[model samples]
Target: MDITKGYSIAYKGLKNGTHDFAFKVGGALFEAYGSAEIMGGDCDVEVKLDKSETQLVADVTIRGDVVVACDRCLEECRVPVDFEGRLLVKFSDEVREYDGEILWLLPGEDEVDLAQYIYESIVLSLPYQRVHPEGGCDPEMLRRFRIVSDKEFAEIEDRAGAEPDNTAWGKLAELKERMEAGPQDDEK
Candidate 1:
């Protein structure tokens, strides 16, 4: 991933303190990481990196809106997104994987590309349903859905009602009634 020059910060030269970085994201940014559900919109990312002697602590906050396809209507709609997370970067001699979140980088690594991570965070923050509010949905699409659902439900109910209720128990009841009457005149 190509890290935007403005988004990268060299922490080695900075004094031990908290530094703030901001980024304005759009469709172009999403394109850098393959095809994304977010087509267009503006999003703001605020990253606060707390530099310490041996470790770097970063608090990332992302907020704004993104255009995504609605699950129900399949129409593009803008959805607000907000996410907050923290990451810890530890300096180490050998490249080692510690769990999943913690990243180990060589002591000499100059800068880190946060673009991919930020992109993933935004995507992960999306809701599973991805639908517009009830009243906000497209009226035409909603009407069509209601019509189809109602028709399907009516068919199911009709089929259920048409089924005969003459179970084995009902047959046994008829048999018992015939026995109580001793035998039919025809049988006699």
Candidate 2:
């Protein structure tokens, strides 16, 4: 069996009704796609397809977890995934991609490939900032980060109050002031 072929739904053979299918994606699937965003995790995808004479509507629910680097501690972490999405498949004379949610199929196309959509849905469901739950990360890492960050913050605060005239920003400010004043002697 083709490893990636499992992702294809042969809608042509099915009668007009609702069909349910489940797929376990990750590991080999991720490797097959060579996706770096989600290297390893267990993702369960449930797809409910409602087929009619001319079109098919699929309701996809993705649930599971994916591995990512923690933003706070920089350690590996598992982020839960739970999201619902819709895909509309319509047959047309010419194949055209409408958007992420809509797919256009050619008249003789026999199946719709869903691997890309499933991958995207799972990846997009991840948090923008991946971090372990509060107090869940490595305590030592957190402590070290806190120490370094606090010291850096203190340095920034110390420098915040003192503006050096030799800096480019200071020179720009002086130039701006001079430009705004524009030969002030004549105006006075």
Candidate 3:
């Protein structure tokens, strides 16, 4: 089936009442929308449309999982999505959108496409910083990062806590003095 076509609500054909629609969307849907932030996902969308003489109200609920790039490891991680959004469609002389939540369409318009709305609802619902739960990153990458991080920490601590006379040349001079005084101390 053509998944993209299902997002349109044909209010003109139906009488004044409530209607229900369901759609299955996944990676292909995002790709078709040319979305770069979200590459793929498996989401079930349920749209409840209430049509009256003057306007239409749509309540959309999206539930499922999305595949996103993990912030820490840059690997694919599946994140669960559960979002609910509302949209108001009003009939006006000219077609325009306002406040991103209201859509105005001409009186004679037969259908309103909701593809963009669905995409935005799902995308905005995602967390700003996407990552795995604590310690869930790739083992190899974490290990390498830890090794480099430990070396950096050691260097920082050494510089912050070391005394002026504790430098490499100072340490060498102290070792030389100790060697010169070793035999004299043993004889005493």
Candidate 4:
């Protein structure tokens, strides 16, 4: 059986209560989405659907490990992701905007394919910048990264001081001292 099929609910035939659904997504499912940078792993998805007289409310939760390449070492690392969000589905003769989280569907529509919604929720759960936690990365990789970052920090500090050439500035100071000791250039 297609594992993902369990993630969707046929709200038309449901009773006016709550229904629970679960799905296990793998790399194959992400591949279908086209050009996704997901590694082969299992993720658990739980969806709670509440059927109402006018609309359906779905609360989705995703949790599991995803393998991603380390930004420093370029080595594979497992990143755990967990997040939950809600979606509202409204049935209307004509598409109407209910709210930011609400979606309008045609009255004639029999079922809502929730695959996209679930996928988006999971994707949004990921951190904006996927990086390993401090001290959680490879030792050798950390060493190299430190070297590069240290040099960059030093350059930034120098620029912030507004001395383009430290040595040149020192020489200019010496020249000013000599002029002050001798005849003042401004007096000439």
Which tens-of-lDDT digit does each residue in 1-188 have in candidate 3? Answer: 76677789888988898999888888878887788878799999998999999999999999998999888877788888999999999989975766678988899999988888888888899988999998888864553344445466456446546566664435544665678677665556
> How do all models score by TM-score?
0.70, 0.73, 0.73, 0.64
Model 1 lDDT per residue over 1-188, tens place: 45344456678887798999888888877777665688876889999999889988889999998899888887788889899999788899998975537767799987866776678888889888788888677765554445445466455445546556375434544565578799568856
RMSD of 2: 11.6
What is candidate 2's lDDT per residue for 1-188, written digit by digit as tens? 55678899998999999999999887677777787766688989999999999899999999999888798997889999998999999888975876887888997999988988887788788999999998889875664455345466456445645656565434544665688787778756
Worst 10 residues of 3 by lDDT: 141-150
Q: What digit string (tens of lDDT, one per residue) describes model 4 on residues 1-188?
A: 65445456667888998999888878766666652556655789888989888888888888997777767666677778797889899887887964648878898876767767766766667666666777677775554445445466455455547555455334544564587699756966
**Between 1 and 3, whose lDDT is larger?**
3
How many Å off is the CA of 121 in candidate 3? 0.6
How far residue 65's Cα lies from its native spot in candidate 3, in Å, is: 1.2
- Who wins the TM-score comparison? 3
Residue 37's lDDT within candidate 1 is 80
Clashes of each: 0, 0, 0, 0
Q: After superposition, how far is residue 111 of candidate 4 from its true place, in Å?
A: 1.9
RMSD of each: 14.7, 11.6, 14.2, 13.1
